[model samples]
Target: MATDPDNPPAEVLAALAAMGFKNTYSGGYTHKDRGKVLDLHFQKDGTDLFQGWKAEEMEANMAAITALFSGIGITITPRVMTLAEAYA
Candidate 1:
């Protein structure tokens, strides 16, 4: 999720909480002038959920996506790696 910790929307927080996720740590992103963070959560059944939000605010279109996946108990686990980090 591309979001600032200070002002995450209510819906975002609630959905994350319901999925049993907890924010572990985050890092600063100089290029984007935004704080890039990694949030981790685990399900007892060992499911994975990964999604991203890049817009200024939660756009109406994207909101439906999470809801649809979340309702079905689907977690989209993405393979996250930076180009530099991966090549290193």
Candidate 2:
């Protein structure tokens, strides 16, 4: 419940960074032209949530997130939303 809101946990940020996501000043991370794939706003309490633009992207990122966080006993939830939902 106590989180930065403007930034993910350092470990999560580092992991995502290692996987090619770049943090932005607006409290989210993006990759290439993929837009914002991860954000603190998507997080729910103890869970780390990821929202990808497409199935392929979500699948790929899910695997990487699982691989990275599962080792440390953290749970990552990956989701896909339409562009409208993503913006709304």
Candidate 3:
């Protein structure tokens, strides 16, 4: 695991991209706040996810990511940013 949040593990980034999560604010940045690891926003627009990703796909994708994270012993959890918190 990379110590830099802007550049997390390659596999983590890949999985996030594959899951339609946009790197709105890397380095765990979010709406004037900073946490750890990364801040991946799923929907740039209100309730609008990436094309072809769809709402239903999130479950499976998340499952895969969870598995991958578990394999790597990553216990970092993510949160959903409000529309006002996300990028405009």
lDDT string, candidate 1, 25-80, tens digits = 54544335455544433322222234543343234433544665677676755456
Better of 1 and 2 by lDDT: 2
Residue lDDT tens for model 2, 4-87: 444547786666677776644344445577554444432212223444346566567668778887887878675668999979
TM-score each candidate.
0.34, 0.43, 0.43
- The C-alpha lDDT values of all candidates are 0.50, 0.57, 0.58
Candidate 3, residue 9: the lDDT equals 67
In model 2, which runs have C-alpha deviations exceeding 4 angstroms?
1-8, 26-58
lDDT of 3 by residue, 1-88 (tens): 3245655567767876776666664344334335455544443222344444456565666676688788878764758889988766
lDDT value, residue 33 of candidate 3: 38
**By summed lDDT, which 10 consecutive residues of candidate 3 come out lowest?**
39-48
Clashes of 1: 1
